[model samples]
Target: MTQSKTWSQRFESALHPAIARFNASIGFDIELIEYDLTGSVAHAKMLAKTGIITPEEGDRLVEGLEQIRQEYREGKFVPGIDAEDVHFAVERRLTELVGDVGKKLHTARSRNDQVGTDTRLYLRDRICRIREKLRDFQGILLDLAESHIETLIPGYTHLQRAQPVSLAHHLLAYFEMAQRDWERLGEIYQRVNISPLGSGALAGTTFPIDRRYTAELLGFGGVYANSLDGVSDRDFAVEFLAAASLIMVHLSRLSEEMILWASEEFGFIRLTDSCATGSSIMPQKKNPDVPELVRGKTGRVFG
Candidate 1:
């Protein structure tokens, strides 16, 4: 990437590089490039439709954006530090490719809205993926349940055995737990699918922007009712993390049981060699490391 003018260059003083890098979000937000490009393309079409930019200019913007998207897909788009975030990085590259007309891409938007919209798009797609993987896990458990219908396992409460239960029943408890997680993700998606692109900065754009049109183009459920909340809201992210915490807790609880079952003192279950770890000095010691690691990850997620 060529040297591009920092947006802060207009201030007639350069920030200390460390401070600039500290404030930069590109390190993490680069993941937003694809969604950002998708939003830009949709916004460009809306701009042309609303007579904000010429149709020809909108075409050029789309073409340039597509090229950048291709570059990103091919791992050829490297963002410089001064670009601050993926939005600025892509815009700088777009301007270089299409000249001044690329400047008009931000005519009725701001980074606040752009980031909000990109995050929604990214998380919405991921929620679907999480649901799919979670369903697969349920199917695996159901298969195990089908095969172990008569295998008697002791049901425990407060670390005391209560009664003998079928292994199928034991596994189904977890199956039901995971099902709730799957349901929560679906609930989160309703709030995560709203578009926030027309909310310029914190308030909104002066130019007539058809928020509904942009939302439709992006396949969002609807536009945000409040412009300030559209850009500033972190509820979607917070709610996702909360849901994730529950999922992790469910996983950790299962892992704890498996870990206990794998112990020699319990001897109720034995993990396969592929997942178990053998101690360096103890030839008879096979550790349930995978379950232990899963248990550890719950703490990290909680933290």
Candidate 2:
């Protein structure tokens, strides 16, 4: 069956199969559906508030968008390859639900700003979750440190034993790394909370819409001062990557320590049965695969 094309009117010919396959992003951008719908709902309300669209029309648009969200939650709203990306997919579904009024939801916005807004919302939520996970990890580290305060282990320099140290002090080093990572995420969140919805394309829209109102509705700190900067800036994403790389570096270091300590030569720690695996041929060999995997995968995050 021929899939319906969302961008056919602007072009004279059907896109080549290879070009279409390469251009389609629904495979991964489906993750942004929920965030796109949320931004749409906020935009619709802003349109109504500013008299760009009738309040009744805005209500219909919001109702249709919410219905699509419900359909997604129930596993019924599936977007196929024809939709291109999450923004187009939601608009296509909204029009099906509310007819022409659903089409009015995009009056004061561009897909440039739409996608920018969606990405910021998604990253903001994810940063909060990551921070929480780091908090929990710090708690675990603290508990272990408290229990091992009296336990002594050999401190090493150049992989050779140099002096005695409390295991609690060693664990606290990781706690400090995690604390710094948590603070970095908090700083990144502030940058991610700015709204870009009114910056249509790379320029401000002609519509007399309220950007600040939409930002407030979406729980953002403020609207972007420069429209071009608002839609094009990805510094927050790069900052997040830098901070995540540091976090992985710390994790890889800790994994290296655990791997060394668990070995017979070090004899400072033991690999529990649930946390280790037996070798294929060696009858008595228990492998520290968990830490080994962590150490190996750290390079992926750095890249």
Candidate 3:
């Protein structure tokens, strides 16, 4: 059986369940557990190498963290409300698994630096994935262009048909925009790949930490030189948002063309029913809802 609760535990017990749930970021951020474990293991090894912690303790922590990672990957782990973020959740579980030694794993680091490192790593991976998706989307556009190399379509200016253009040319316009988006994502990836592990709190630690070691361990190309800059820098997040905005704008333009092409007034092409919807009242009305939603979502992305 569990031990009796302390006053703080009892106080937290009295809190509202919704408040508890709202405070728990585990639902979404639990995806960072593996990255957190990887960072911790690297930091622990660094600590041991620098004689900050015993080699025995470092090995124990590394083994325990790997076990926790396996638990999460194998779908055997269940994060509790008390486990705030992935960092806390992993540390708490580590303590449970290996006693006092697990607590020592955070000796030279703070949650600020840890979270910063984890988020950067996660974002870097996400940016790579998004680049791949953009490439595939670009390839689709290129293929469509090749297929319609000589097909003529009305080019619009201010929603009015102003001139004729080859369908291939119009499709290539989206390809060009997508290529730019891909380049932007790559640029953001470079900016976000800097390591933030050694920036403890808002300042550097007294311990002889090798930031470069942890950076290399985590596949970061380099470390943030200033501790304060490392902890407070969110330029990567802003760049990612900017990249997303451009991608959304390109998608919105394509969606607008799709909407126009599917309409009766400008029936240049037909969108398959799988990509459209039908009106509740008008039996003959087929709506390009997917493109409409994509176009509408562009505003949210812009905001």
RMSD of each: 2.2, 1.6, 3.4
Better of 1 and 3 by lDDT: 1
Question: By summed lDDT, which 10 consecutive residues of candidate 1 come out lowest?
Answer: 1-10
The count of backbone overlaps in candidate 2 is 0
Worst 10 residues of 2 by lDDT: 1-10
Model 2: residues >4 Å from true position, as ranges? Answer: 1-5
Q: For candidate 2, lDDT tens digit of each residue in 1-303?
A: 244456678766676666666789999999998999999999999999999999999999999999999999999999988778878889989999999888898898988999999999999999999899999999999999999999998898998889999999999999999999999999999999999989999988899999999999999999899999999989988898899889889988999989888888887888889999997799888898998999899889888
> What is the number of backbone collisions in each predicted candidate, taken in the order shown?
0, 0, 0
Model 3 misplaced regions, further than 4 Å: 1-23
Please give the lDDT score for candidate 2.
Answer: 0.91
What's the lDDT for candidate 3?
0.87
Which residue pairs overlap in candidate 1's backbone?
none
Candidate 3's error at 281, in angstroms?
4.2
TM-score per model over all chains: 0.94, 0.95, 0.89
Ranking according to TM-score, highest score first: 2, 1, 3
